[model samples]
Target: MDRTARILQDLYDSEINFTIATFWHAGFQIKLGLGDEVNGFDATGTADNLVDAVEWLRVQAIKKYPESVFATNYRR
Candidate 1:
């Protein structure tokens, strides 16, 4: 897996209050969450293209971590 893929996998698998891999819909900075309250990141860069990143992540996750989607949704 590539670096980006690894980060996103970690995010989907996270159990912490703050996961740095949690990115808002932008370039890639980091999404902040206090308990169940999350704040959007003010991202700016080439890395924050989440629309494309999400599809890539979903594909990789389905292949490697099929159960992660449930975990991800539960986190919401």
Candidate 2:
């Protein structure tokens, strides 16, 4: 697979949403998210919005990583 696909797959495996910025010849940025259940990112970029997806992911992550620190940051 390519770099973008690999990165996306990794995010999916981790069950975390991500904000990725892609650059073009002029270095443009495009952010994308992977998870539907977790507000993996604080930015406005979202891949999909399944009902109760964010809540479900939050519960799962809380159970899986009790001591982990996870939050969404929307500052650019």
Candidate 3:
């Protein structure tokens, strides 16, 4: 599967309850929705690979919504 699809599958498998899932190789942007809304990391970023992209999401989840229980089982 593609990057975005694969990522979404990971979220679904974990029951993350995210409504938004976007990733782009161009600057490696990522946007995720959870906990009823989104407030931070709502922009594009640069990632060297899938691993970096996943890490970015995790970090952003912590930064934007630290109280949330965000987890991604996707491995690069």
Best by lDDT, which number?
3
Candidate scoring better on lDDT of 1 and 3:
3
Residue-level lDDT of model 2, residues 45-67, one tens digit each, is 32233323333344444444444
- Residue 28 displacement in candidate 3 (angstroms): 2.8
State every prediction's TM-score relative to the real structure. Answer: 0.28, 0.29, 0.45
Cα-lDDT of candidate 1: 0.42
Tens-digit lDDT track for model 3 on 1-76? 9665665566555454443344554545455544444554343455766667666665654555554434323322
Better of 2 and 3 by lDDT: 3
Cα-based lDDT for every prediction: 0.42, 0.39, 0.52
Candidate 1, superposed: residue stretches over 4 Å from native: 1-48, 67-76
Which residue pairs collide, candidate 1? 26-48, 27-48, 28-48
Which candidate leads the pack in TM-score?
3
Model 1 C-alpha lDDT per residue in residues 1-76, reported as the tens digit of each score: 8755655556555532222343355454333222443553222123356555444444433444345543454332
Show the lowest summed lDDT stretch of 10 residues, model 2.
67-76
- Report the backbone clash tally of model 3: 0
Candidate 3 residue pairs in clash (backbone atoms < 3 Å): none
The lDDT ranking, best first, is 3, 1, 2
